[model samples]
Target: MTQRLRFRTSIVLSCFVATNALAHEGHDHPHEAASAPQQMVATAAGPEANSFVADGVTYQWKHRPDLGLQPEAMVAAAKPGLHNNADEDPETGEVVTVVANYGLVKLDQQMKSWSLVDDQDPHFAGGMNSHGMDCFTIDGEVYYASASTNTQEVVVSKRGKVIARLESPKGTEFDNPGVNAYYKSGGRFVPCDVVWVPTAKRLLVVTGYSNGDFAISARRVDGAWKWDGVAFGGRIQQGGPFLTGHGIELKITEDGIETVQIASRGHGRLYGFTPNGAMINLNATEGQYYAQLHNAARPCNLDFQGDLTFVPLLDSLPSTNGVAPVMVLKNFESTGSLIPAEFDDLQFMRHMHGLKTVRRDRKLFAITLSWRNGGENGQGKLNDGQIAIFEAVATQ
Candidate 1:
């Protein structure tokens, strides 16, 4: 059964609330009781069915009810050896997908179960409190972004072995490549997202909410990683980069023009910029779209296919009719309105937190993370989350 969500003009501020209260305090530091693992329940036939279609998209979904995953981000591998050091399925000889939860988790092709990559790795010195934010693979090397404000380093691993560690750049210049100041001030890096542009040989990192004015950090990695410079808001005084940088994506035009898209969560808007820091007009009316769309809230992780952009609204507030978790904007290059996509009437979809596009067997798939129901850490009592996968099908 599909339920239509009603759109309204009155935007709720509650939708933009931050989850810092539940954020990881520091690496290797003892904390209160951790969230309990979810019980592995038999896949139900009702709303929890394994397959469903929505908005002309057919999806094959799976849930690990036994794992309590906060699912912050993920990196998909279509074939073995592409991401060196990845664990292989003994039965299939294929590389398993890597997901960022408390640490790194490997998901088999079945997607119904998962296992920790290496909890003993010194890189994950935080143990269960280690918050893995984002991940990317390049040149057979996998980079895991550890948001540990205390450690504040990007752990580089190959074939499941810890190899190198990229520490946050140390400097005070606005253009220096480094983690957000919040992390330098004994807080978490809050690294919301990371994107590697092979064409330019650069890595882009965005902070969710940091102390300094600059939120986006870019580094050049030709043969060696070096601070390329930073941009987005340019300098702190201009107040134009990002209010709360949450998600980032790199778009290259047919003419070879590269533009960086950022999800400014605090301002409820999305901004575009050149590789350096100049802003690109998003053609949005009223300066931004999120603030204009009452049905939309805090825009988070974004994935781009051609000109269409898929943005997940990570707001927990109930919608006027119900919660509309995802939004698709057509003709995003031009001025286009937000189109809400229903989550197959799954009531718990309102708790979704992350979004990423993956490929398997040469087909594209969209994956979303649903935090344990209630809220972070199950709203005080620990609980697990759900990983939903949808196969993108052409609209007929």
Candidate 2:
């Protein structure tokens, strides 16, 4: 049978459980749930070649190498590299997406165009293949939190102009005993992902290499960012030593509870923690500790909407029969999936690294970043990068 056929059969036989639960997670066999066979969408011959409609939402996957930016200004963004993370500003619908070793670019409010902001020439940030961008506002002023992996610092910018660089300054809270060791990278920091918490008034930065969230005071007390110490993590959870800490998102509920969903990429587990570094157990495992969700190897990032979460797997998994790419999890269980070749060809979007969910004008969009997978040329650049936007319009 063809790969798609094989995948469909597997899904029918075992539902959406991509693979057997991790041996440590305690399931020896595949999970069984009642699920109808997925309806396949016929392929089309155009820009949007691969499209599907499920649950009243039309999902179209388009490879975006050229972000519609002017050729001359696409100096860094145009080339094939790790086009990693994409974050949108809710108030304006503007997006700030990043490419490692290239730099950052802005996706216009229209959601279909791109541009280079002033003072953002060259676009490259000197990082290797791991960088994340987040758009947030503080006190009516908007700013972006970009993980500068190369230097292990957080580059904060506004209107495309970098206003401050938050680093572990000497003789500060970061230098405090026991606190400095958890976030040390070449004696600095290796921030993989960053998000600003408005309620707590801090920036939770993932120490990408060290494996945990480091809370940096965004209050700018006396004109400098203060290190609030490690928020949560440091080799002591169910999955210890969460190396390569990659993606994170903030959720503030109506009851005044704030939870940050974190992707421990290295360990292939998802965790949730509060602003004060307390673990929030949403999965209801057994103890006071949080429950870890297992999916794919090096699961890069997460985007939560309502009760579901959108996760992009950085690589394949054997349990998935080697075809897992992107997953939609509801209550920490796979409820929907976008298999490889279902969205595009088997070769394209091979590695799903980053994901973000955006809602604007009554439409819901899922923006995903695929690192180093060239769909057009078959065997293009090894470090090639691409973005796929899947929009789901609301039903009347």
Top candidate, metric lDDT: 2
What C-alpha lDDT values do all the predictions have? 0.42, 0.54
Task: Give the per-residue lDDT digits (tens) of candidate 1, residues 373-396.
Answer: 333343653323445556554333
TM-score of each: 0.59, 0.72
The CA lDDT at 112 in model 2 is 71
Which digits, one per residue and each the tens of the lDDT, describe model 2 over residues 171-254? 245423334443342233557778888777778877644323333334456655666553445432323324345777886654
Show where candidate 2 strays beyond 4 Å.
1-79, 100-103, 119-130, 168-176, 181-188, 211-218, 236-241, 319-324, 339-341, 373-383, 393-396
Counting clashing residue pairs in each candidate, in order, gives 7, 4
* Angstrom error at residue 58, model 1: 10
- The residue pairs that clash in candidate 1, if any, are 28-126, 84-159, 85-158, 85-159, 85-160, 232-241, 233-241
Q: In candidate 1, which residue ranges exceed 4 Å CA deviation?
A: 1-102, 109-113, 118-122, 125-152, 163-168, 172-189, 216-228, 232-238, 284-296, 316-324, 333-347, 359-364, 372-384, 393-396
Judge candidate 1 at residue 52 and give its lDDT.
Answer: 34
Q: Evaluated with TM-score, which candidate comes out highest?
A: 2
